[model samples]
Target: MKRRKRKRYVSTDIRKSENGATFLSILITFVIVMITLPLLVYLLTYVQPVKHNNELSVNQFFIFLRNDVLTSEQVYTDDDNKMYFLLPTDEVAHIEQYQNVIRRQVNGRGHEIYLRDIDSFTLQPISFGTQVTIVTKEGREYEKKIAHYE
Candidate 1:
């Protein structure tokens, strides 16, 4: 009877080298990560925050304006393009562009800044309400139509 010989499989040196990541591959991966990390951090920390803050501020301004208009007894824009809201308590809220900022005055007193870095602010009387358009110094345009309660 002939006996069958079992063949032993041995891993070569080349096979061992290819089994895991080499020094060159690890170094290249580290270099790629180092190159991309700073750019990602810069975009997340610097580039996005400024624009995001600007937009957030503008939105908050709009919300405040809308709330003031909706809760007021009357809303009107004067010949000088300044907006006025007559509240239920007989208090007048005046909103106008003062230099490079939009300010709010209560009964023609106090300086309350609503928005800053403004290039232009316009209030156009629409059929249903007023269309407020603001142009920022950075060339950004934002418009919102706030409706009157009555």
Candidate 2:
């Protein structure tokens, strides 16, 4: 009787294949980042945040004030600090400054900040009621008149 010889099977090298995939992924990521970086920077350079100017702030304040006070039963102002009132929706809303930001709070809830870099905020008396005046660090001032309903 003749004995048959068995052939040995070799397994694939996992280390080499693993290293290649890892290196390729890393190289592709690096290339993508490199390609997008310049475009991102360019877009950022042209992209300016909505400025916190006095005019815009005052206008926005008046809009909010009108909307709130139109149906409010009562309103109060702390001059440069804040204005609190009841909205038409029966929700209480307060607009005030926190540090350098102008924030609005409603129903004792979230503090929604609107404008930033406010140097000064003042409520000035007007023909009918009061006007909001916001001054920025650049010495630019904005004012808007408001009306109160009885």
Candidate 3:
């Protein structure tokens, strides 16, 4: 009878190297940040809050104008600096920009200042709508158009 010797196995390597997933995660994060940073800076510098006499800003005024035009039955521009909207209730509402103020008259309930600190403004008739251009005292310009009879 012959006796065979068994071989013993010894473990030596213990330290683990970085996996491909770790490198992939860092690469993905870097790409996302690179794309987002430029857009964030552009929006922060381009969109700014307006200086106002009270709570209203030029942004809010445009929102109101947009709502008015969307809900109105007809829109008309008188001369150069005046525009009117005929609402669903048959109420004639008007907006006038004179001097350095923008005024809104709702359903003949008298007029109120929509915004101030304006340098100049123009209300004109376009091919399909009325266009409003407002230049504030700070040299910031805001333009909006309201489509008529929509």
Candidate 4:
């Protein structure tokens, strides 16, 4: 019987040198930081509570205006710093007197009042609560409760 000698196995090197590995790690880290920096800045600046008021106001304005019950004629900010919603009405007598400003009249129950001559309204953030009011062309007013934004 002839005996055969076994060959020694050697491990092949797949990894780069220590310095090259360190450089590659640093490059990867820098790329990740650059990609995330702008997103972080944007979220910190634009998506903060500091913009809550403006965001709520703009959303409220659009929502109330788009109600199907009301017809929008004109939307303008008045000298009194109040935003006004202009509406047209001919159903009720003396409604023409309040062509621009909304008119309120006490109901028969006296607990609530009806309003007319308003196109739409936004609920300004008030300490009391979130209240939305709207008016139709037929001189009808509708009020609704809304969720308040923090």
Candidate 5:
């Protein structure tokens, strides 16, 4: 009887394929994460953050003053009825009071009650506040939320 020759089988390179897939997956995920991080941070800050001076209400200002932040100075009200409260530092407090104000060129305009004076404010770091400035579709400026010092 004649004997048949044995056949040999060759192994496939499966490791290369697996490594390529792993690398690709990791790269794609990293890119996606990096892109989303900044957007998320921007949204959070835009929705809320610390200190908004552009537009503040009298009630809000009063709240800060009541906290013993503003001394007898660092405040001014313009002649046209614009109230200016500037706390330069621990040493300089400027206060002013005015009335019948129109639009203040220096600080912009709304109503007119200028209160101006110079005094000293105690320098104490209270809790921080978050300010949000967002532009509306109609081109109006609105304060979203008043963050309190907690």
Candidate 6:
């Protein structure tokens, strides 16, 4: 009986194949980064948050005041730029401009800011209620005539 020897087949080097795959992956990652970097930078540089100004604040203040006045039992103004509200709950709410900000106080106690960046605030007595005017530090003027029911 004769024994036959089997021939060994050598495979390709693993390192050579791995090096090509690593280089291809690196190139793909670099291309993706390069394409996205400019877009990201543009978004960061051009996209901005909505700016808030005294005009918007004043408008919001007027909206709140109108709602309060509509619900209040009585609305009146003092000698200065101050308005008072007699709530149904019998609590007094005072609205006034202190320094450069308009604030509200309940029962003459807590200090809550309503509007800011004020240059001047005026309350003119009208027939039914008062005419409110506000001048911002930026020289913008806002005026509203709020009337009370009953």
Per-residue lDDT over 29-138 for candidate 1, one digit per residue giving the tens place of the 0 to 100 score: 99999999999988877554334766787899999999888888888899897999898999999999999999999999999999999999999989999999999888
User: What lDDT does each candidate get?
Assistant: 0.89, 0.76, 0.80, 0.44, 0.39, 0.89
Candidate 3 lDDT, tens digit per residue, 28-144? 999999999999999899887765643358878888888878888887777757778887787899988756888888875776888888888798789988788888887878888
Q: Candidate 5, overall lDDT? A: 0.39
In model 3, residue pairs whose N, Cα or C atoms come closer than 3 Å (at least 3 residues apart or on different chains), thus clashing, are none
Identify the runs in model 5 with alpha carbons over 4 angstroms from their true place.
1-21, 49-150
Give candidate 2 regions above 4 Å deviation. Answer: 1-58, 88-90, 125-127
lDDT of 5 at 86: 42
Q: How does model 6 score by TM-score?
A: 0.65
If both were scored by TM-score, which would come out higher, candidate 1 or candidate 5? Answer: 1
Model 6: residue 128 alpha-carbon error in angstroms: 2.5
lDDT winner between 4 and 5, please give it: 4
Q: Would you estimate the TM-scores of all the predictions?
A: 0.69, 0.54, 0.57, 0.21, 0.21, 0.65
In model 1, what are the clashing residue pairs, if there are any?
none
Task: List all candidate RMSDs to the true structure.
Answer: 5.7, 12.7, 10.8, 15.3, 15.2, 9.6
What is candidate 2's lDDT per residue for 38-118, written digit by digit as tens? 999998998878765556665776686677677687777874567778666788888887887788898878988877778
lDDT of 5 by residue, 92-120 (tens): 32223332111222333343332122121
Query: If candidate 3 were superposed on the true structure by all CA atoms, what would the RMSD be?
Result: 10.8
Model 6 C-alpha lDDT per residue in residues 1-150, reported as the tens digit of each score: 999986675875565453355777889999999999999999899878776666678889999989989989988889987899999999999899999998999999999998888899999999888899999998889999998888
User: Which sections of candidate 4 miss by over 4 Å?
Assistant: 1-7, 13-50, 68-150
Evaluated at residue 47, the lDDT of candidate 1 is 52
Which one is best on TM-score?
1
Q: Give the better candidate number (2 or 5) by TM-score.
A: 2
